[model samples]
Target: MLPYSEEHAQFRDTVRRFVEREVAPHHARWESEGAVDRDLWRKAGDAGLLLTNIPADYGGGDGDFLTSVIMIEEFMRGVFSGPGFRLHSDIVAPYILHLGTEEQKRSILPRMASGETIGAVAMTEPGAGSDLASIRTIARREGNELVVSGQKTFITNGGLADLIVVACKTDPAAGAKGVSLVLVEADRPGFSRGKNLEKIGMKAQDTSELFFDEVRVPASNLLGTEGKGFAHLMTELPRERLLVGIVAVSVMEAALCWTLDHVHERKAFGRPLIEFQNTRFVLAEVKTKVTVARTFLDDCVLRLMRGELDVATAAMAKWWLSDLECEVVDACLQMFGGYGYMREYPIARAYEDARVHRIYAGSNEIMKELVARSL
Candidate 1:
């Protein structure tokens, strides 16, 4: 059995209660609406469920990495299916806390923790998905203000975010060295929202196309320096990928358990579906794979706690577990027979939602390349 401290277990219980009360009842409605209500964000912030890792001095909960991991795991287990909390709290907030100046942090952190503002990190443009050097978004400083101009697509939390951490080219001549990160407020002129792009799954997430047409912001908004964005991205990616790994493993665990339960209750030929040799073998394989995945993921979590989890390892965990998740879910859906194909079934929804894990936050192929660097 995996080990956990009493405090950690208690924290897990808290997360479960929050999910059961706040997430469970509204998930279907949110899924149908293509976006969750804004009030839920405030509820999470009120409960100290968002940005638990940032220090309490900045209005955060002052929780540890494990707390964030617990939240991710619990959210996945429930298939909460809405909001980009992982993208905001787990992924982007660290960049500001670790790298941004005092002014940047003070300007952004309090609102982020309070859920007074939504946060989004814009790194992927249509032209540059995985390849960072290919980014074409330009940020030119004219006097004391940085003028940003570009279009970013597939931005998570794009429609809802009040603050965006944007990546842009500061010196096109310097290639990868040209990139920089800056904070942009949604209320700023020339910074405008576009259509919420329709997607096959994760419909409640409110993905959108963001256009920055000569959006001008104060010098104080530049995160860190003018040319550290790509390197900063490299530094941040391991954590982001690690978070993705945590989500993948947790969801796979939930899906596996869900399938087992589903098959046991669903009978055919006067015997439960679980009685079939095929079903038993399938579940056995799933159980073993999920256990192995948990083992690796938990080890990664420990290493992350020790500040030793590297980019390559995170990539391995993410790609491998995500592939396993898709496989396990597809098998689970098969056990449901025709019922799984229907949109009303949770498994069917999961099957649809799980398809993108292999593709987003960098494709599995790109993940392999990152891992290959270790050799």
Candidate 2:
């Protein structure tokens, strides 16, 4: 079991209540509307759920990474996917907190913590996904400003992001060494968002096409050292991948619980499903698999807190747990039989939401490549 202090327990309770009160009721509406309501972001901020790990001086909760973990686990337990809170709190906020100038942090992190400004990192372009070096997005320096021109697809929080950390090739001739990260405000003159994209899963989370047409920003908007963006991404990605593993294991745990509850109560062939030998065996396998996954996930979390989690171990955790999550959730859904196929059922939604864990945070294939290089 993971270590949890009394404070952590109280924080978990807070997140649980938030999920029940703010998320569970209107998620279906958000799903139908193709994105979550903007009000939810403000509410999450007010509830101290937006930036739990950010320092309190910056309007954050002054908590550790475990707080974010609790939020993910609680949300996934409810099959809640409408909000991009994880991407906002754990992923985007950290970029600024870690790499931005002190002035940038002083200005941006407080607004992000309060949900006044939503954040996104735009890295994947139309022609580039895993190949970060191949991106055609260019940020040409003009005197004291950088004019950015490119299109980014599949950006999380793209529809309502107030600030975006866009990855651009500031020195294209240097290949990977030329890449840079630039902070672009959403209302910049040439910046525009395409319609929210529809997906088979994660329907309620806004994913969109972002266009940067000569959007210019002061050179001061550069995040980290100019031309060091790729290395910066490498340094931060382990945490992001570990976050995906946390989500994967949580989904597996919840899926197993839903299946077990169904098997114990549902009658099949005039007998409770749990009484059947095959039913017992299937659940047995699932229980063992989930237990192992939980143990590994906890170990990874500990390593992360200690700053010992490397890219290889993180890649292993991301690819393996995500693959296992898909397998386990699929198995658990099978136990629900016809009911699993219904969208209204939580298990069905869990199945849909679990899919992208492998695809995002770097595809499982690229994860394997990273692991292979370490061998």
Candidate 3:
């Protein structure tokens, strides 16, 4: 049976059309500019595509988590990698909804849902890559406010994010127990964004470095309880890892489709490339890998919806699918020959995009260790 319901299928159709109309047409320009247009965010909000799964009371569509999944899958398949909507909708919004106080939720979720405020999470710092306990950023309580001072690097949506959830040590003496998530507005004094960092791929996604030099926010801006940021991150990371797996499977499927089209149309020795024994055999292997990845990803998505997705299972899905994505994209690019290396071709960009899947959302190496721990 398919994992999606009738409602999910209908929603997918809506997202597919939106991607074609709004995202696909302008992606090249966004890629060159190193960031997407701010207007695109508002347009996405107008289409009700920004935060589909948040509550209706918060200006969201109040759809289920599967709604977000459909949107991510559609965006990946459409090759619309610039917007960072998955980070905004699936990751940041959930932190607020699950951990933020009523006042914070009422204040922020509406703007997020409407795209009036772009959100980014600042967890990875200059010193900490995957180790949350090693974060050196500190949030000091002073009277009625918290003073944050530190540097966060490789922050997605960083150049344009109006709101950022910063991970810092509120009590450095307490190790992991000292960590806290603090909300900081971009316009605040002492909070400055560095240049939009140039990247190997996903160039238009506005990744950057953020510096907080004693930036101050009300104590109320703290997300969840103080001294429990690590715990909150642990609770939410399974979903984030699952999101990575979904993107991997989607990209793998798109790459295979693109390759199949190219192989069938391109000729070698007066015959279509697909007619060759070598071409057919290579594609057969890719198809089998993609099919297996998709099936596993679908099962993981369903498990996620049922609140049964464990960390180890999510880790397994993330690493396996991402590795498969890189391998499949590489094979597809080889089929395109020289054209695949040129940026003008989607395969080239897909090749660039596929490399990072193994690095982010907890590196594939980290995923293996997490899985190993379960054994």
Candidate 4:
């Protein structure tokens, strides 16, 4: 609806078909296995579904940000949370594209585009979540090599990551200014992954703890300038937060549709659930809330395309829409009565998945603080 061209329309159709044919069938299996099949990434890459915004020279689809938006929207429409493609393409790839040197991009981005190598970013540590400045990961220089010593947890795609953009403290006394982004190859001697972490939701996505026990890499692997990692992260936060916003509204929209279908066919008292005044009122409220959220989401997406989106506005979108998503899903779940509690239902899975949106990409509380600082 946001001024999508004919190409966008066709792409959406392709994504919809792809999701139905490839993702939906195996999503339950992935959830049970605690990770999507490794081959899914290759299939997605072959379909031009990965790195939609990166340039063609790097083996990407040469599409814009809207293409990525279409991809996210279609995936959420079916409530399939198994693949970590969004994190792989939109989140982690950008860091490399924007910050890495030409040699880095030439060697890595093409393989990533081909899905031959998976990527992940390591930032969150056991003691540090929202407070990235407090992370204790140390990268000590030893001649031409850098020895990385620290642990990162809750890393998406960690188990399969072939390349990781690691956040390290190059100067411990300088606080946030001490942080630097170092690119570490996963096969390094001391680099290892813990078991895939189990979670309450998004069970099909692999999230794990990554340990760097003096993992070593060349000095040339440093991303951007030394001691500028926090600034680099700040430059990218708006996009990441906006991504959360995109997922939030997409899930809300899907949940509303599911609830609508259920209420129309489901019976309560002597008639359909939709016949009840209370049910009607709840649906009306949900519809209105979701409509408003969609409008705001579209505006933010347009701003992102125009390169005009600011940190505060992006923060508002992230926190507000994520909160609304959880609220809408909970209300929709309640409408299903006992059936909502069962895992067989899509709405139940949605209810479980809606929770982490508030906590990740900087918690909703952190988002509010960021906005307040701007005010």
Please identify model 1 stretches exceeding 4 Å from their true place: 1-3
User: What does candidate 4's lDDT look like per residue over 301-336, in tens digits?
Assistant: 999989999999999999999999999999999999
Q: Estimate each model's TM-score.
A: 0.97, 0.99, 0.98, 0.98
Candidate achieving higher lDDT, 2 or 4? 2
Question: What TM-score quantifies how close candidate 2 is to the native fold?
Answer: 0.99
Whole-model lDDT, model 1: 0.86
lDDT of 1 by residue, 179-293 (tens): 9998899999999988888888887788988999999998778887789888998888888877777877787788787788888899999999999999999989888988898
* Ten contiguous residues minimizing lDDT sum, candidate 1: 1-10
Q: What total of clashing residue pairs does each candidate reach?
A: 0, 0, 0, 0
The lDDT leader among the candidates is 2
* 3 against 4, candidate with superior lDDT: 4
Superior by TM-score: candidate 1 or candidate 3: 3
Model 1 Cα RMSD, 1 decimal: 1.3
Give the per-residue lDDT digits (tens) of candidate 2, residues 246-318: 9999989999888988998999889999999988998899999999999999999999988899999999999
True lDDT of residue 245, candidate 1 = 76
Locate the minimum summed-lDDT window of 10 residues in model 4: 78-87
